[model samples]
Target: MAVLVPYAAARPKTRLSDFLDSPERVSFSRAMLADVVDAVVDSGGNPTVLATEPVELDADATVEVDDRPLSTAVNDRLAAAADDGDDSTAVVMSDLALATPRVLSRFFDADGDLVVAPGRGGGTNALVVRHPEFRVDYHGTSYLDHLRVARDIGASVREFDSMRLSTDIDEPEDLVEVLLHTDGRARDWLLDAGFTVDVRKGRVGVRRER
Candidate 1:
């Protein structure tokens, strides 16, 4: 299947957005997208990046980057992928803390015209569409609200586990939960990137100033 990673917002999009509120979170978002790509490539899958930026720095031959807004550009990129006519398509978000190949494999294994996992925070975290000429009406919560649209278009539908397709990284509280699931590799990454993690040795919060 052709995997789609949509990076719609830039590093700092607007004040109303969460990731833009702090510079640290902006860097975190960028790394999160990169990690999503790493997970896909490690799974020996074809990956594409639908970026809102003009140019992509890490796009390889196996990956093609498209610059477009999430509402319009994402579908445009997927349409281009479908043009090749060689693969089914799965459109996924980039800010998942626990995105593993096994989790994604579940979606690939399902039998449906569209396999969707509802997002924890409304909308959908992942979408798998088997039909060409697939049009998107990606407005507020429409990713989940558009099941009728899929039915209207004569497409079959199925749902997957939410934990496998979560995009829960818009708040610091979410970050705290993500760190709970970070394995050795991801933990080492956090350390290497200057984010410290220390478990409480006693009934006290772990703290080390500087």
Candidate 2:
């Protein structure tokens, strides 16, 4: 299967700006992207990085720079894949720090013309598009919009439910999940940066050592 990993290199993980500085945010974002790409490769899928700007990464994938909005860039790839008669193409978010090969394999093997893995806060974390008419819209509540788009095109839809696949690291709170559940580069980067899980009032959060 062909996998498209969308990445914003210029200004990534803006929600974590309060916790991480500009350079650190870019580094952390690239770490998560590497982890996601590794998972996709291990799961037997070919990945292409659709980046906003040129980026240097230690991943075995092709880099394609498309400065267009997320939806437009992804749809263009989807259309091109359809024209090429590809069996199925997947759009995996670059920030899925917790994604593993097992989770991605299950998602790729799911039986559906359109398989969606919804992220926290109604975002579409990952999706496999087999229907030729299916396109993506990355606006607000994009998960719901994807489902509606699938239904309107008469494509069979399946929602793949997996905690690892659902978690995309964008906010400072999300860093906790990577530290707790992941053993990849993202987790290592956070740990090396002195981020540790802190429980306050029975709620889990991250604390960076000074």
Give the count of colliding residue pairs in each prediction.
0, 0
- The C-alpha stretches of model 1 lying farther than 4 A from their native spots are 12-22, 54-65, 184-210
TM-score for each model: 0.77, 0.98
TM-score of model number 1:
0.77
On residues 70-182, what C-alpha lDDT tens digit does candidate 1 reach at each position?
Answer: 65876776577678874578877777657777777777678887888777656777788887756566647876665876888788888787574765455534554445665
Provide the RMSD of all predictions against the true structure, rounded to 1 decimal.
Answer: 4.2, 0.8
Per residue, candidate 2 scores C-alpha lDDT tens digits across 90-114 of 9999999989999899999999999
lDDT of candidates 1 onward, in order? 0.62, 0.94
Q: Identify the candidate with maximal TM-score.
A: 2
In terms of lDDT, model 2 sits at 0.94
